[model samples]
Target: MAQITKAGLTFPIMNSGNRHGEVSGEPLPILMRYWRARRNPRDIPALPQTVRRATGLTQQDVAYLAGVSVRWYRQLENGVAADYSADLLDRVATALDLSPAERATLYLRAVGRPPTPYSPLQEDTAECWDQDLLQLFVDNQEPMPSYATDLSWNVVAHNLTLRRWFPWAAHGANLMRWVFLEPEARQHLVNWESDWARPFLGQLRYERAHHPANAALAQLERAILAGSQDARELWHRREVVEHSHGAVRRLRLPYHQGQEVTVRMVTVRPLRTVALCVNLLVECANPGGPSAS
Candidate 1:
């Protein structure tokens, strides 16, 4: 864990943790240099004036709410400003009353990073409607279990089939919370040591790095940390997983015989950039043989 300095920036060199057993690192200053040299936060799109009009707030009023000077806020909204900290962006997001998805976008923009762009989620504010749509989609899967989840894994929708397959899904329906909080599910995770914690921990780390002020997300994170040493250790790693695609595992599933269900989770990123993860449970057509890892 030795820290090195270069060009007034600090970085760490660490072990490879692999067969190569090599130590490598990136200089924080260098990454910043590249980011600053090639990046521009001004590229972040401005909040719409119409949205502001709807709020009945003028530019100065909005700036007041955001705790920034009128000129500075104007420059930001005008796309003439560059570089904003997460805290500052959070303040602006609060002023706008942006949804979690919109707030995340603002944070990315403030840091001179472009958000992942995709289509919007279906337009529906009614929770019941969202859940209904989700249920309908997953219900058709039948023996192949699937569930619909919001960005944070709040159980917006799930079929009875999935709920029956994973009883824990019925208990509150928040994926992040349930994964860390459920006693039975916790033990069922084969690698509660790492795999079980890494994905969600990494996802939260990513969210916090940008929207660090989210009280609800922060509270949930602290709660999770309070429960598991593994969660606490993984949180400190500060890694991020986009969860858009690649290998995914269900550590416990009745269909998979409580063995890890190594399934490929497909993600449909709506224009809002919130991930819609679909877990396709592909098991052997024949049943009753020794379960595959």
Candidate 2:
């Protein structure tokens, strides 16, 4: 009698009694069939070959787009590089113009783990805002600078007072874009590096992870990275943090001229909606004072 061990179970071999109740001519177990199929020569393609066939991009093009040297990219495609970081793979995926599914496939083939999936929420911009809630937020805040943002951080609504104060919080202006791309933001935000840029980027990273399929968000990310070297470096760091509330900061308000204003920034979420959040910036009593909101 002969025996074989599979999945920690012992089974009789073909020469022995058939444990699977097969009459001598029956097919192998499903697991064995799958194993055999995986060994088929026609089923697998080299990573370099796949990239060539899938994107029709030259090695030099991929290297330049991914911010890697041509020598390194060639080695990676040829499977000679023993180690590659996920960050590098991500850049390669972006350079190749891969879809979410194709990106997952690339990760699986290269690293043996499927990349995180991105299933963007179906909520449209029109459905993201509630006029009643926006009115309530604006009305209740009175003189405070308050505004609402959708999931993509687009300023959906704001009170007249906020516009009077910042003037740049235009309707539909993306917060990330305004902060990174707008020159006025750099001038106004006193602690642009610590208070605004890094924290805001962490929040954007969280959003990108959760909503990877969002085309607009992806485009915005690309634009920011291309426009700012600092932003690109921070993005590659892969640091993630929650959007903070009740943080106080000094701003060189255009309205206030050279003097800085201490303001307490608070973020709030309305009932039954994950898409809308309200941010309130209330003036502090004294310069460099603790948050009052």
Candidate 3:
């Protein structure tokens, strides 16, 4: 009688430990059957194209590093074919220079791990110096309610209680976004047709000339055109202004405050990477006040 056990065991007498422990050929057949099923590329998981965009690497580059053909990698990205062996998948992960989160995604897709969410880093990330510089403006209480802003004036951070005065401060959420898109800005602005809009339009043109390949800047330009016809016209004029400094503008607080405030705007280039504007809002000691030097 043949002994009943895993793998092919031909035996007349059942031995407890006949050969050194090793997987028998019987298990190999079953393993091959499961392996064949697992090798289908379409059945396995793969990282999304969005993930690739976030990682900032092209598929061709990733494939070359992974030692796989570019066509095969594209097929993997598209979930077209499955030949992802554990070892091969490991090579691919390393080639992509994946973060821990990204590596985990690939692992799950290859093996039977649960799907997890991965957040990719954006390219136009502001540096720590930018934050520090922005904070300096906020902490200095010259009663001048000072704040710093980025090119789009997203108000990455601000200390001014001016959030109360200029409702635009909130809209300053994204400087370029507010300038070109917001309807309230277009209607309520004192000089939407000329002064205020002109300089910003000029600065934007200068920025375009300097950074034509800058994706964030390009996206902003696109948004402006998409958001408003006026913005489109302003862009076409090609007015270019270097946002260094000049005269100040009087901004009225929203309907609630109704107080007209004189704000001196100064641009400081502490770093070459980011252009910063420090806005110092003037307050009055008397009813009709003179400007603070």
Rank the candidate models, highest TM-score first. Answer: 2, 3, 1
TM-score per candidate: 0.48, 0.56, 0.49
| Candidate 3 lDDT over residue span 144-167, tens digit each | 566666555556555547565555
What TM-score would you give candidate 3 relative to the actual structure? 0.49
The deviation in Å at residue 145 for candidate 1 is: 1.4
Q: Deviation in angstroms for 290 in model 1?
A: 16
- Report the C-alpha lDDT of model 2 over 89-190, residue by residue, as the tens digit: 777665554556656655554454566543223534334455886878676887888888777777778888888876777655777877876777888888
Best by TM-score: 2
Global lDDT scores for all candidate models: 0.53, 0.63, 0.51
Q: Rank the candidates by lDDT, best first.
A: 2, 1, 3
Q: What are the clashing pairs of model 1?
A: 118-270, 118-271, 119-270, 119-271, 120-271
Clash pairs detected, candidate 3: 7-26, 40-82, 41-81, 41-82, 152-175, 153-175, 154-173
The prediction achieving the highest lDDT against the true structure is 2
lDDT for model 2 comes to: 0.63
